[model samples]
Structure formats: C-alpha cells, structure tokens
Target: MWKEAAAGASPDLEFRAPVDAAALAEAERRLGRSLPGQLTALLKETNGVADGYGTDIVWSLDRVVEHNLQFWSPDTFPGLYMPFDPLLFFGDNGGGDQFAFVLTPERPDIFVWDHENDSRLWAARELKDYLHRSLLGEGDWYR
Candidate 1:
C-alpha cells in the first residue's frame, strides 16, 4: 500500500528496508510519543521513501528519531523559532524546509514548516495525500 501510494504518483521513487516493530517501539520510547498509525504502517512496509533525485520524501526510522529529538530539544534552535514540541518532523524538501505531523492535539494532517520564516501551514489531509502531492509535484508543491 505504501509503495502503491507513491508509485501511483511516480514509478521512480526509491525505498529503503522496512523497520521492525522493536525499532519502532524504541523510537516511540525515545520520543515519548507514538508515531501516527499511518506513518508506523508505512515504516513497517519501508523504512523510508525517496524521490528519483535521492531526496528523502520519507525519512528512515533512525533519521526520524534523531531529527525529532533535535527539534524537540531547546538547545537546538533556542528562540530562533517557535517551540517544536507540538510537531514531529519526518522529511524535508531538500531546500531546508520540512514536513511534519502535529502531535499536541494528535491530528493526521500534514504540514510544511517553512525554514526561512518559520511558518507552519497545512499541506495535506493525511499521509497518503502528502505522499501523492510531495511525490507527484515539485519541491514547493505544498506552497
């Protein structure tokens, strides 16, 4: 289903090995929150997804853990932008902008975090919508 979602948009998308349940559990433990169910299912099918140009459309489990940890840490940005505690960043646009899921209220919608101005805006309805848009469209499709 995960592959089909992207393949429906582009056949050239790349994929990495699937992550095991244990690893996902560890990641959740580290983040102090569970990953969205759709995302977890996708990770179980493939650890990550990338475009033909090697851009990470969906980051691997390890990168997911590390990136979110950094974003959640106060020392990482420290007044440069809004607190990242409410977001769980997953991938990037290869131009410093990133994609994430809102965790505070636990919503399924996907949003783009503009790097320059630090604005958070709705991008897609859910993971599948995000995949189709991000895979079929160019770098700034969300905008």
Candidate 2:
C-alpha cells in the first residue's frame, strides 16, 4: 500500500530497508508490548515511507522507537499526556496531527490524534484499509 504512495521519482519517497526481526523484537521488548501484526509486517517490508510524504510518512524502525519513547517515557519531560498502552503513533500529517493504533485491548483499529483539537477519531478498522486510503489519498485524517 504505502510502497506506492511512498514511491516516487523523488528521492524522499525512497524505501528504507525492511526492519530486522531482532530489531523489531528488541523494540517490542523495550516497549513491553506486542506490535500489531499488520503494522509490524508492513514495517518489515519497508521500515517506513520517507520524509516529506505528508501524513503518509511511515517512520523508520529507529524513529519508531525514538518517537514512542519520547512520547511514552516519563523520563522524557513534556511527554505525551496520556499513557502508552492506548496510543502508539506511527505517522504524521506533516502538520502536527498524529495517526496511531490503540493497543490496550489489542485491536487493529486506527485512530487520528488531532494536534489542534486534541481529539481522537477512528480512521480505519484494519491496516489494509488504512493503507489503501492512505495510498489513494482519500481521507481527511492526513491534513
């Protein structure tokens, strides 16, 4: 899905190497939570879409860990106000809005965390659907 939206003649859309299982496992270990299978699988295909790809930007594995920890860790001051179990941001709108998945109960449902309004809206229920919409540029969630 993202492989196309993220693909382009431009250099910014270049695909990164797939994340190694050991690294993904280590991330999970550090996070103490199992990553969504679909999300992990997608990342395993390509770490993430490159920069300047709008809301479709899929952060790299290192960025994933960095982002999550920056927002989820108490040691990081001014961290995200909420807890990590419920929200794990993976993409950005190139603005401030964030796209994330809820993990407390372990569902694949995706949500948009609006930066302006501090609202969480359900975007898609499955990773495939979300990726399709993203590739097609069909949703308002990105902006």
Candidate 3:
C-alpha cells in the first residue's frame, strides 16, 4: 500500500528494504513509546522513502529512533524552540523543516515543524496524504 502510494506520487522515490519485527521492537524500546500504526506499517513495507535527489521523505527505523530520541531530550535542543516532547518526527524537507505526528493527543494528522520560526502547523490528514503531497509537489508542499 505504501509503496504504491509513493510510486503513484512519483516513481523516482527510492525504497529501502522492509524492517523486521525485532528492529521495530528495538526502535520502540529505544524511544520508550509505540510507533504510530501507519508509520509502523509503512516501515514494515519499506524501511524508508527517499526522493530522487536523496532527501529522506520518510526516514529509516534507526534514523527515526535516533532523531526522536534527540528531539525528546530536553537538553538536545536550545531554549529558543518549543519543547519537542509532543511530536514524533519521521521525515524532513530538504531544508531544515521536519514533519511529525502529534503523540500527546494520539492523532493521525501530520504536522510540519519549521526549524527557522519554530512553528508546528498541520501538513496532512495522515501518512498517505503526507506522502502524496510531499512526494508529488516541489518545495514546502505543506505551505
């Protein structure tokens, strides 16, 4: 389902091998939280999604775990930005902006975190919608 959705958006997307259950479990363990169902299913289908120019539209399991851990850490970010505890980052624009799902309310909607302005705004309804928009459109499609 994920691969087809991505391909439909753009055949140029590069897909990595599927992540195993053990890797998923380890990722969850390291993050101290369960992964979202759509993200988990997508990772099980393919570890990551890359664009033609090598941007990580959806990061691999290991990258996902590492990035989230860093974001969740209070010391990792400067006091200039808002707390990242409520966001589960999974992807980024080629620029500094990142995409995430809200975990505090456990919603499926996707949001974009603008690294420059520190704004968290709605990007898509869910993972599939995010994929279609981000993959098919150029630049910050969410805006």
Name the TM-score of candidate 2. 0.78
Tell me the tens digit of each residue's lDDT in model 2 across 1-143: 54653443234454778888999999999887878887798898898775444444567777777788777877664544545547888876676777788887778898888776668888777766665555556447344
Candidate 2 clashing pairs, residues 3+ apart or interchain = none
Q: Write the candidate numbers in order of decreasing lDDT.
A: 3, 1, 2
Which prediction has more favorable lDDT, 2 or 3? 3
In model 2, the worst 10-residue window by lDDT is 5-14
Error of 2 at 66 (Å): 1.2
Whose lDDT is higher: candidate 1's or candidate 2's? 1
Error of 2 at 108 (Å): 0.9
Residue 4, candidate 3: how far off, in angstroms?
0.5
Residues 33-139, model 3: lDDT tens digits? 99999999999999999999999999999999999998888888778789998999999998999999999999999999999999999999999999999988877
The C-alpha stretches of model 1 lying farther than 4 A from their native spots are none
List candidate 2 segments past 4 Å from native.
Answer: 1-13, 51-56, 75-84, 138-143
**Candidate-wise lDDT, in order:** 0.92, 0.71, 0.94
Worst 10 residues of 3 by lDDT: 71-80
Name model 3 segments beyond 4 Å from true: none
lDDT of 2 at 33: 80
What's the true lDDT of residue 107 in model 1?
A: 95
Question: Which should have the higher TM-score, number 2 or number 3?
Answer: 3
